[model samples]
Target: MRMRTKAVLLIVFLSCLAGCGSREPSAQSPQAASSSHADSGEIVLEADSLKLGQIRTAPVVVQAAPWDEFETPGRVELDPNRVSHVLMPVPGRIRQVLVRLGDAVQEGQPLLIIESPEVSAAVAAYRQAQAELRRAQSALSKAERDLSRIRDLFANRAAAQRDVWAAENEVAQAQAAVEQAKAEQEQARHRLELLGISPNEPVQQISVPAPTSGKVLEIAVAAGEFRTDTSTSLMTIADLSHVWITANVPENLIRLVQIGENVEVELAAYPGEVLRGTVRRIADTLDAETRTVKVQTELPNPSGRLRPGMFGRIRHSHGLKPVAAVPPAALVQDNEGAFVYLEKGRGRFQRRRVRAGQPRNGWAPITEGLSPGERVVVDGAILLSGK
Candidate 1:
């Protein structure tokens, strides 16, 4: 048994010795390889070089032809040409209101009937003047006949000279009376006309008619409201065929606006329907409070989709043309002025100062100090600045 145990122990010791030998080679080889790698200067330099600071690139392209640009923000207004107000020239109780707010009206169409004692009195005076004119005309005609007879008699020596002279005087007096009566009649007619009554010889009621074809925007007085004075505005009307878009353009941008320039308008109430217009008017003065110019663009309201007071936006373009520009993001505001990082060469760039014009197509026109076909650091410009 002791001999068997000794042989078995020797075999186990040899096996342990082989396993220790294998472990020594594995651990020693790895340490030697690590030390060798630590001594390699080329690899360290290559690793440092590989980290050559992150860089970004943006392609430079010439501004394409037919690039459109514009600005927005406006409000709808009444078209002055289509707007009218119906007012009572003579103060009286409104006998009836034939139209309501937003009612379409035609030229000379009766809008209301105002019952006024003053108007009636005017009519009566006009009729009395007409009667006087007729009576004076009759008297004048009779006097003329008498004058003819007297002239014949005097020629035949059958009438006295005093009688003929008296007849002539009477005829002359009648003629003067007719002239006075005609003048009075004309005065009465004018009075009636001023009161908005028809020039009919016998006027019954006054019809307040719309002076122009338009839509009534408001009716300040009701059926029984009294118009006390000329200051009272009984009704307001407007023409809806055309409308004005009042836009507040920034003062700095006012020069871009001009008469007859095309403007695109969009109303929130009518989404996606673009209304075309032209810059018809611009306020000579700027608003001190907002420091903006009031620009008015006239747009056709044919469908009547655009109503007064509807909020909208207006876009006025300076006219698109060929220009050298780049993405606005590339521009960096600096004390020296606007500038961009222009790529000088491979892995190199330099800051370039540039003058800019109004931004068009998301790019600003480089008025000076920049050219087309030059690569710029549009993105990652902030990162480059840190460097």
Candidate 2:
């Protein structure tokens, strides 16, 4: 029985030894050790492996580009300089509206018609002036003939000298009256012209023409409505082919905005499309309540896709500044934030955390944690990231 117990003890001891041996870790090969490090986010690729992975490296360049920029909320607005306010030239009742709001118009195009008694009175005065001028001309012609006949009679001693002098005086008076009548006629004609009434045609309604070529933005008059306020606007027209993006920049950053500098514009309506513009104007004064300065950027819209009141984000680039930059594709984001792969040594790369600034033209400016002349993994960064 003792011998049997010894055999069982021996078997137990062997079982324990086997269990401990199985629990011990196996020695890792060099490839396995390298792969373990790579799996922990420390990628050490050999030159051949990098070639097979199609990895590309580029030196972090010191670039002088638009690195100093600030984004401000803005909105598209009609360029006030290009806007036109169509006002009533005279008090009249609206007889017809030739165009509607938002209708494109050319200069001198008839926009509306108004029936005004003032227009009719102007035409009547012009006609009366014409009649008076004709009458004066006839009188002057008669006086000249009389004066000639009197002079001939005096030379033949058939008329007195006093009568000849009186006839001369009468001729001069007639000439003066003709001059006066001509002046009145011209004055009347100008009045008719100012009223937009043709002197040759009978005046019925005054046709109001557009003073400028633009799109009608507002119409305050309707057909049959009497607009007696000559100072009030009848319509508002705006040239929308070009627009202004008005941004209220903070007072502190107002000095950064320089007129004539190029700016980038992005509208909420069209995502991923960038519109280029130039800083055209800046307000001389700041808003007292908001403590902000108004900056205006002129944006051309040949396609007329941009409309007034559209919200936009304006990025004003003051000027170019030297900064460390890398290809935009090198940036990778994860829970740790934006980062790039640095080529630490030959056939080796390490992940680096970076604070990226605004990107321009497929290049990203590294605001922090990067320096010029360092080589970074531009292509195949994703391969390292995935591992």
**Per-residue lDDT for 224 in model 2?**
92
Error of 1 at 99 (Å): 3.4
Clashing pairs in 1: 73-313, 73-314, 82-239, 83-238, 83-239
Off by over 4 Å in 1: 1-58, 64-76, 79-82, 160-165, 186-206, 245-297, 306-321, 332-338, 345-351, 378-387
**Top lDDT prediction, candidate number:** 2
Worst lDDT run of 10 residues, candidate 1, spans 41-50
**Cα RMSD, model 2:** 9.2
Model 1 C-alpha lDDT per residue in residues 111-229, reported as the tens digit of each score? 88887778778888888999999999999999999999999999999999999999999999999999999999999999977777765645445778888877888888878877778
RMSD of each: 13.0, 9.2
The CA lDDT at 308 in model 1 is 88
TM-score for every candidate vs. truth? 0.65, 0.65
lDDT, model 2, position 63? 70
